[model samples]
Target: MKVEIWSDVMCPFCYIGKHNFEKALENLPFKNEVEVEWKSFQLDPTLNPSETKTTVEYFKEKKGIPEAQASQMVSQVAQMGQMAEIDFNFEKALITNTFPAHRLIHLAKKHNLSSEVEEALFEAHFIDGENVGSIDLLVSIAEKLGIDKEEAQKVLNSDTFDQEVNQDIADAQNNGITGVPFFVLNGKYAVSGAQPVETFVNALQQTYNETVSPFKDLSDGGTSCDADGCSI
Candidate 1:
């Protein structure tokens, strides 16, 4: 089974959802048969890379929420993160564009380090409060993943993977995806948001068991004849 996840690195729920999904996979009988592909999505694509503001301030400015309300919102999300054992420091988070980070993720995909890059980006932004839009920071993260720094830097410095990133966003739009942490299982089942671990497990098992047909029969018995006799 293949699972495609559309996520934005800066999205707090994406991190939480990833951990929940990981827990689900761990408990699944067919875990070894599952393939996970990370797709890019930008929550704020128009945000300037050079902008210097805390995430709370950005929310206040962009969403028209008061600073106190934004802080409360952040606190609520942080409490949710605690459920996933993720330490989210929203106050430290920097408001910046994620396009560069997404492009680096695309580059990392070719080298089979996309997952690592994604985790590192989430940690950098949410935990370490690093500027994800910085080419230097992205290159450093790639280097930590054992990717060639020069090659990674070259990709970041150029327009490489720009279309790949855009294509991922385009595909998300075509799929009617309106949020992050959206998961598609076997290209058939779509699970939106940071669903609970049990929910993901059920979805995985249900999709895996749907081999014979997409439509399921809930009736206990049908009017089928056996070799011995016909059933009522």
Candidate 2:
């Protein structure tokens, strides 16, 4: 079974979804056979690198919510993250343009270290509160993960993987995905949002069982509606 997840490192639910999916995989009988790929998905493609705003401020401006409400909402998210064993330092988190980070991930995919780099990026941005948009920070993280630092720096400085990152975004849009934490199994089954562990486990098990053929469409064409209207 192959699972391609379209998620952003800055997304809180994406982090939680990663944990849930990993837990599911840990209990799966065919864990060793499963191939997990972290596809790039940016939450803010238009954001400027010069922009300096906390996630709370960004949410307040984007959603037109009051500062107090935004702070409460962030606090709630922090609590939820704690429950999932993710330490989210929202206080120091800098709302960044993730295009560069996505490009680095594309480069990491070539080396089969995409998952490691993805987790490092998420930790840098959400937990460690590093400026992920910075080229230096990205290169530093890449170096720590055994990726060629100088080569990564060159790639980051240049627009090497920009097209691939943009293509992933375009493909996500074409597939009707408008949010993070979208899971695509075997290029067929797609479950959007941070679904429960049981949901992911069931999908993985079903996909594993139906591996007799190369192309298996596991998605049932079900409605994409959640409690808050149709999921984007």
Candidate 3:
């Protein structure tokens, strides 16, 4: 089954959703057969990558909510992170444009290291409270993930992978998606937000059953050959 996840590293819920989604996969017998692709989506595309503010400030400014409300909401998200076993340091989290970070993810996808880089981005933004939009920071993150440092720096420094990142954002818009952590299972079922682990597990099974071929009940009559001998 192919699972495409539309997410933003700046969104704490997206990180939580990733954790729960991976946990759900662990409960499945066909876990290894499942393919997960992280698609990029920027919550605030217009924000400048070079300029960053605390996540709380960004939330208040965009949502037009009071500081108290925004702080309360942040607290609620912190609790959710606890449930997902992620230690989110929102106070330190810098909010900036995720476009550059998304580009790095696209670069990682080329080497089949997208998921690894995605997790590192999440940790950089939410846990370590670093500016994910920084070219130097992104290159260092890629280096840690076994991606060639020069290649990563080149990709991040130039316009490489920009189209792939833009295409992902365009896809989310074309699909009328207005939120982060939107999951598409088997190119059919859609799960939005950080839903419960059970919800993900059920969706995985439903999609897998619908798409995968079932085992044939050949033990009753059909003949087969194995290392030991051929059935007579």
Candidate 4:
């Protein structure tokens, strides 16, 4: 079974979903047979490098919420992260444009270090409060991961893997994805949001047990309305 996830580094739910999915896989019987792919999705594409706002400030401005409410909300998210064994230092967390980080992730995928890079980016952003959008920080992290520092620096300094990251974003858009932590199972079934571990395990089991039938028409053939239009 192959599972692809579209998520952003700054997305708290993505980290939570990652943890839940890992727990689910750990308990699955065919965990060794499953392959996972992490796709890129940017929550804020127009973010500028000069923006020095904290996550709390960004949320307050974006959602039009008061600073106090935003702080409380972040605190709640921090507590939830703690429960999942993720240390989220919202106090020092900086709001950054994740496009560069996504590009590095694509490059890491080519070297079979995508998972390591993803985890490192998440930890840098949420736990260590490091600016993952910075090339210097990314190169440092890549070096720490045993990847050739000069090669990684060269990739970051140039436009390498930028197209791949853009393609991933385009693919996510084509799939009608509007949020992070979206999971696609076997390129057929999709589940959105940070669901519980049991839910993910059940979905994994269902996908594993079902056989792909080329001649069978398994489509639900339902119609739905959205902001774009109504479609079947």
TM-score winner between 2 and 3, please give it.
Answer: 3
Q: Output the TM-score of candidate 2.
A: 0.89
Order of the predicted models by TM-score, top scorer first: 1, 3, 2, 4
Q: Report lDDT per candidate.
A: 0.91, 0.87, 0.91, 0.87
Candidate 1, TM-score vs. the true structure?
Answer: 0.91
Candidate 2 lDDT, 1-232, residue by residue in tens: 6899999978999988888888888998899998888888888877887565898999998899999999999999888888778888999999978888988899899888888898898898888888889999999888888889889989999999989888888898999899989999998788787777898899988888878555767897877987789955
Candidate 2 vs candidate 3: which has greater lDDT?
3
lDDT of 3 by residue, 111-145 (tens): 99988998999999998988999999999999999
lDDT of 2 at 30: 93
lDDT by residue (tens digit), candidate 1, 64-134 = 99999999999999999999999999878997989999989999899988878989999999999999999
lDDT (Cα, 0-100) at 10 in candidate 3: 91
TM-score, prediction 4? 0.88
Q: Point out where model 2 deviates above 4 Å.
A: 213-232
Number of the candidate with higher TM-score, 1 or 2: 1
Runs in model 1 lying further than 4 Å from the true structure: 211-232
